[model samples]
Target: MENKLIVSSSPHVRSNQDTSYIMKQVVIATFVTMVGMLLKAYIPALGDALGLFIPLIVVNCLILARAESFASKNTPIKSAVDGIGMGLGFTLALTALGVVREILGNGTLFGMGLFGASYQPALLFILPPGAFLSLGFLLAGFNKLKNKKA
Candidate 1:
């Protein structure tokens, strides 16, 4: 009577959690924290410039959309590749826009004058409306190129 073995009516249950899946989540979290810390520490100016946007990168729509639509269903390596490709595409697009905006608005590329002392920058390009015009033109150019390729 002292030793009794009793079994419940519930079925056996097992968890689907695995080492790799848990490790991947931990690594991603650690990486994002480290990036935010490093940005705050080493690049204060850029951190200030970016403000909340830098910290919000993890929850950005582009990242969230890709993670849900693809990363969750794909292998880690494939997901990483997709992330890298998307990051590069984003970087390139921003660089192109910046180059155009800076040259037209300030007559400079990264604070170095490209058009010499006599150059007169278009003040309109430096204003808020100029940003919209620049983006629209860039999108149009990219679309034209894409269409030509097809």
Candidate 2:
């Protein structure tokens, strides 16, 4: 009788420290930078409206929070997709808030009047505190619906 031993040829350890992750990071960073530049160059009106806020996106806490928590734990591709989803979520939230404020405060949607000329727009809804009130109501509505479903 003879004794024999065999070993399989495969990686025994898994690691995140790899060229693929590094390249993905680089690609995502470059794409974000390019998008910023394009927004500034092509959307002059928006650039003017937002002014320095555009540049402030680099230091935006929403982005930083996701990067620090989600991106750090997830794979590179997943992190990138999550970043996009977060952005869309943010956009939808802001747009909803803006629409609510506009309709209540100005009686207009995208500058088109929805109410009769005799209707009075609520000035209080246009002020800074109005943002807080609108957001609170929106959140409350969402919570009510969520609880109902649950």
Candidate 3:
């Protein structure tokens, strides 16, 4: 007697959503996030610090990925909610990351010194390498917590 076995990759599912619809959902979500940010922090100094990067958040990878992967497959309301969540997640992560790095590299956060004078800042943390290191650590932490909850 002979037995047959099959091996295959994950199956694909189809959805009725289209690109234009997904783009609209992403726009809606981005607008909401922007409005919230504007209301919460109206300081021009923050604007100056973020500058062009603030506008570029619309095209951020996190937003686009959520659009193509989550928004495209879900209803408009659901897509918008997902987009908002993802956008806020990015915002908080970057903010926290910058704060941590600033404290380590400059001995200050938001213009307030955490360490007294003569405390040598970890100059390396402010550099590109430090960005990478901080991001990696943050992602690892998020992953660990997410997996634990699941």
**Per-model TM-score versus the true fold:** 0.53, 0.60, 0.56
Q: Model 1 clash pairs?
A: none
Candidates in descending TM-score order: 2, 3, 1
Candidate 3 TM-score, C-alpha based:
0.56
lDDT for residue 74 in candidate 3, whole number 0-100: 87
Q: Each model's RMSD to truth, in Å?
A: 13.8, 15.2, 13.7
**Candidate maximizing lDDT:** 2
What local distance difference test score does each model get? Answer: 0.69, 0.70, 0.69
Tens-digit lDDT string for candidate 3 (1-150): 000011111122112335433444455556755754784478767767766666565546446755677865789999888878888887898898998799888999889888899799999899969988888888899899999999
Off by over 4 Å in 1: 1-59
Tens-digit per-residue lDDT, 41-90, candidate 1: 99988767877675465435445555555777899999888888888887
Extract clashing residue pairs from model 2: none
